[model samples]
Target: DQQVKQNSPSLSVQEGRISILNCDYTNSMFDYFLWYKKYPAEGPTFLISISSIKDKNEDGRFTVFLNKSAKHLSLHIVPSQPGDSAVYFCAASALYISSGSARQLTFGSGTQLTVLP
Candidate 1:
C-alpha cells in the first residue's frame, strides 16, 4: 500500500526560529514529492518540491531534504514568521501514483505550524 505519513500533528516555534516538519513513505515508486501550506478556509498552496533524483532542494526560507534509502523526507523553514502560522501538508506522487491514470494526490494528515510573535 502507498502511504505518506506525517508523524507530528503540530509544531510551534518563535518568530525567526527554524521550523521542521517530517514525513515518511513506504512506496518505492514515488518519484515526485511536494509540500503544500494551507491557511484556514483556503486550498493548499504549493511551497516547494523535490524530484526523487535530487537529494535536497531549497528556495529562500524553505528547504527540503530527501533520504531515499530511508524513505524519509523533511521540510525546514528558517526564520519563521507569524504569517507562517498554518497547517502544512506533505504530499507524494509518482508517475503512476494514480490507479486509473487520473492524477491523484496522497497527502499526509498535516501538521499545524505556529510561529509566535
Candidate 2:
C-alpha cells in the first residue's frame, strides 16, 4: 500500500551536523507515528514516536515532528555523528478494536542516512 512514503531514498550528511528525514502519509486515521533506525543485516529499532495530539517529541539529539493537518512528519537529528548513519524508516499506526488488540504499523520504504567525517 502507498499509505506511507519517503520521497527521498537516501540522504548524506557530515558529522557534527544536522540530518533531516521526511515522510508523508495518506491515511488520516493514523494517530501514532514512529521512526526506526536500522543497520545492515539487522532489524529496525524504534527511535522515537509522536501521537497526533502532540506536535513535537524529542529524545536527546533526535526529534520527531508531526503535522496532522498536512499529513506529514519528519525526524531531525542534531549534531549527527558517524554512528548515526543508518537506514531510517517512518511508521504509522491507527488504533483498532479488533480482538481487543491493536498496534499494527505501516512503514515507509526507508531513507538511508550517511554521516561523513
Of the candidates shown, which would achieve the greatest lDDT relative to the real structure? 2
- Reference-based lDDT, residue 112, model 1: 98
Per-model CA lDDT versus the true structure: 0.93, 0.95
Candidate 2, 1-117: lDDT as tens digits: 999999999999999999999999999888999999999999999999999999999999999999888999999999999999999999999877872446799999999999999
Estimate TM-scores for all models: 0.93, 0.96
TM-score of 2: 0.96
RMSD, candidate 1, Å? 1.9
Tens-digit lDDT string for candidate 1 (1-117): 439999999999999999999999998878889999999999999999999999999999999999999999999999899999999999998766447565477899999999999
How many clashes in each candidate?
0, 0
Off by over 4 Å in 2: none
Evaluated with TM-score, which candidate comes out highest? 2
